[model samples]
Target: MATPRLFVKGTVLGYKRTRTIQRPSSTLLQLEGVNVKEDTGFYLGKRVCYVYKVGRESRCIWGRITRAHGNSGVVRARFQHNLPPQSFGATVRVHLFPSSI
Candidate 1:
């Protein structure tokens, strides 16, 4: 019951496989690979995405950080059966690594 934290890497700012309430869910998302370090409010580069709930309805990839509540940053990955095979708009090429210590 303790094995759900898969995020090979990061930087994939695009991907969506919608469908819920019934079934089908697969999420391989990213967007949080740009840090400059400030006061510690998380706004260095601005962009949050880390949803890794591979197909089977076990979703739990949420995100939130509104300065006051304007809205433009959100990664609501609510899966239930199938969502993660992107190619809708096309422009994918996300590669980020640095965790092999």
Candidate 2:
């Protein structure tokens, strides 16, 4: 049974950060069912979007998956506009575009 979905679900763990610094331009994410480092390879260069509700309207923040974040299947996303702090722990949609699939 094939579905009509065109994207995958991703979680915004947080922004790329260090012990004393954080870079909002680089956001960290984890895609559903992608639990291995090698599995993340296919997602590289793909686009990602964070959707949020604003009163009765909706908004989105677009980004691209730069590379695998670590050995635990985490991925790093770079956006033109830095994701707001409120996006932390938010659900993002990973699109299989750029025809890389």
Candidate No. with top lDDT = 2
Q: Which pairs clash (backbone N, Cα, C closer than 3 Å) in model 2? A: none
- So what's the TM-score on candidate 2? 0.91
Query: Model 2 over residues 12-72: C-alpha lDDT tens digits?
Result: 9988889999988899998999999999998999999888899999988788999998899
Candidate 1 accuracy as lDDT: 0.32
Off by over 4 Å in 2: none
For candidate 2, give the lDDT: 0.90
In candidate 1, how many clashes are counted?
A: 5
Which predicted model would earn the best TM-score? 2
TM-scores, all candidates, are 0.19, 0.91
**Per-residue lDDT value at 56 in model 1:** 67
